[model samples]
Target chain A: MMGLRLILEQVSHAYRDLSVLDGITLTAAPGEVLVLVGPSGCGKSTLLGIMGGMLAATGGTVSVTGEVAADCLNPLTYVFQDFALLPWRSVAGNIDLVLRARLPKAERQARIAEVLALTNLTEFAGAWPRQLSGGMRQRVGIARALAVRPACLLMDEPLSALDAQTRDLLLDEFAAIIARAGTTTVYVTHNLKEAVRLGHQIVVLSRRPGRIRATVRIDRALTDRTARDPDLLVIGEELWRMIRDDAAAAERERVDAPA
Target chain B: MPRLEGPVHFRAAGFAPKDRAWASAATLLGLLAMWQASASFGLIKSLFLPPPVAIATALWHLTVSGELWKHLSASLMRLFVGWTLGTVFGVGMGLAVGLWSALRSPGMAIVAALFPIPKIALVPLFIIWFGIGEGSKIATLAFGVFFPTVIATAGGVDNVARGLIRMGQSFGLSTGAIVRGIILPGALPAILSGFRVTTSIAIVLLVAAEMIGAERGIGAFVLSAGNLYDTDNLLAGIVVLSVLGLIVAWIIGRLERALLSWR
Candidate 1:
């Protein structure tokens, strides 16, 4: 079966007088991991929010699986930065919530078991969110998203809240999990290294009034080598340069604009 | 001077389980002893401040005559009916006001204005409307209990974490499921506290309402004893009321703990 795809045309959104996203357009093929990277206030999260149906775009159209507002296409799900695990629910309960409405009891239980195993969270099924570390909590977020069996997953800075060591470890686990599921994911982050490590293609957005700056395909290099591949480092450096330049220009614009 | 320490006493001197129990028992005995001493010495007239022994003897006499049971059963019936009805209505209205801005905005204004007026102030009006019978007494107690329960429930619902709601939405739960699964459970602890507070209020109002115009109930028996200057009976009635309040409060506390064990 073909994976889901997303297409956005002339998408613009504004918050009262301040424009956040200006005429943004992009497309992601089925099974592709599109990493949206940019500086702070670059409207990356806002754009992701719009895609996830959490925010309405002021202008333009968004279509998923070749259908705009299709009822059959499940609404996009999110993996938030804060992990956002319901404090009252245990690890398995959090994952079960997404599947409860869509799956039968036996199927839901089977799905929960599969996801918990996939996320290395089988031992944590009964643990509360507070008992889990930051990395583990984010894994629960991922597990919840996976349990829904959605067409697309929109992750906004999912690992930004973790420490460097935890982030590195989870990144490896995430790549393995995503490879198995083959789900189309739009992962948003400001970290260049994360984009290079996880993205099949990187879509760099310029700072506020964000516009798509470039789309760099890195699937070939990432697939052909080990975790410490030199080609991966080269591409990461390239993406960093592009982001740093845009970040500088965005800062200048902020200083020049009237407060 | 030689050290007075035994075994160096290295463990912390803070209240432990054994120490706490001993302290509580000692304080209770001291209070009882003081009451007995005052009555024996006639420091405060025995009529107004009966000794613990005298109160106990009075209780025994009333128990043998079946007088205590009759008034107690009447008062308890009023408390049960009034508190149950009050709790059900209060929680329902509180949840409605909390979940909907349309309901909350106007409803809160009315609740805020009326919650402060002494519910007892309405007792006279209730007596005229419902007559000086069980109807008025039950109405007064119910009204007294309702305000605190509703206010507590509303505040509890309002305080539920917004992040939890968002978390439920992200799971694609419907609006009703989100409120039922997340909001209700999250607000239960606060709501339980409100119940505990209202239980005591219900007891107080029940006795007050009974005293005003009732022929039965502990409050009425105390009033009758006052007319006859049967100080022992009056003291016994007051003691019975205090015990009733303590028992009800304890039951509510147990219920709160059981319901909110997750918290």
Candidate 2:
């Protein structure tokens, strides 16, 4: 799974007059996970969107500056927060939805089979999205993204919607999958634990009209990092400290602001 | 509070309702039996309200004489042709309105303007335009079915999740593929339920158009029977229409089940 290097140059966005993101410059090195963490309403998801070319930055440019693999169907693919699965489609069918346009019948079927196996969803290939638990549904979402064999994966809080136990369970699975694929990933989440678990480099942003606050790098291999590690815990604590006051301020602002 | 002791009452019980097919059949059968008893006892005049047995006898004669098939065939043809035409054009226009910014406002404006003008009231005008032939009858049904379909289909398309569409776009699905695979299936439940309303509307208009002009439909048969004061035949014709409604509803039920098994 060869990956692309994503470069963002002073990217900023505003929804009409209300500015959201400001001069957010970052680079996701090839085959690495770059996690964006911030308080709510910080436009981390919007930044990810711009990086994926799903949304154009209002002020600056985002570009991919590396070779895409020959088998890559989508150079930039997203695994959305809400799962964004087609309810009418079966687990295998949902993955096939993206492959149908690019591959022929036999290859599409084989690709579906491969991704289903990758996500451990092969047994439930015929199951509909609505029939699966939230965790399982998001697994299917990841599998669908993987089926395209993307050059880069843009994941937007893909585990945030699950119950805490499911979130923990799937977090490990996600780390394993991402490491195996080695796709350049720009993952956005509010959970520092997830950021610590998956990210090679973590970027923290201040509250709304988000600006980069801190960048933390973990040299530890993704597979070697564990929740109980003293260094990882310290890094997590430092990140919490960085955003704690801003998170509080953002919360109070929301509660007191006029609708 | 002693940990709020004693068994917790089943407070969440009984909001869900279950369907009983036997109960429905029994209800209809019970009503018919009572009606037959009333007629047998001379409590009601048969001339005013024919007994179920008399109506069944009339139906049996109509069947034997092959009169029922002729009327049934004509009505079925008009219903099929009119409904297919309306659904095809309505869905096409609906997709156009739902997908493109250029067509949305103008299409909705035209729909809103024409939709509320009750289609039954336009039968006379249609007859003048299309002539007092199959053209006018079919046109009446087709027109009656069109507007509601447009509204249902457009609403369906509108309600498809924006996130799903964006997901398709992010995956680089072609515009045509997105519309066919994502948008169509997403909107189908609404479109199918719309079919329920449009089909009934088509039937209603079918009868109205036939009553006004056609010489060989169930509506015409019922009208002529009423003119001759033949209560049994009139009731028989009404029975056929009711049965037709039930059959159409049943077919749609099967279609919904087949298409929406995922739900």
Which candidate's DockQ is highest?
A: 2
Clashing pairs in 1: none
User: What is the C-alpha lDDT profile of model 1 across A1-259, one tens digit per residue?
Assistant: 5577888899999999889898988887777789999987889999998887778999998888733232222447788998877777899988877676667899888888988988989999999888899999999999888877767888889999999999988888877777776778899998877888888889988888888888999766334434577888899888888888778887787788898
The clash numbers for all candidates, in the given order, read 0, 0
Worst 10 residues of 2 chain B by lDDT: B1-10
TM-score of each: 0.87, 0.97
Clashing pairs in 2: none
**Residue A83, model 1, lDDT:** 86
Chain B alone, candidate 1, TM-score of 0.89
Model 1 spans > 4 angstroms off: A66-75, A221-227, A245-259, B1-22, B226-231
Per-candidate interface C-alpha RMSD?
2.1, 0.6
Q: In angstroms, how far off is A134's CA in candidate 2?
A: 1.9
> Which digits, one per residue and each the tens of the lDDT, describe model 2 over residues A1-259?
3569999989999999989999988899998999999998999999988888789889998888888888999999999999999999999899999999789999999989999898889999999999899999999999999999999999999999999999999999998999889899999999999999999999999999999999999987789977677888899999999999999999998999999
lDDT of 2 by residue, B210-243 (tens): 8998898988888999999999999999999989
What does chain B score (TM) in every candidate? 0.89, 0.95
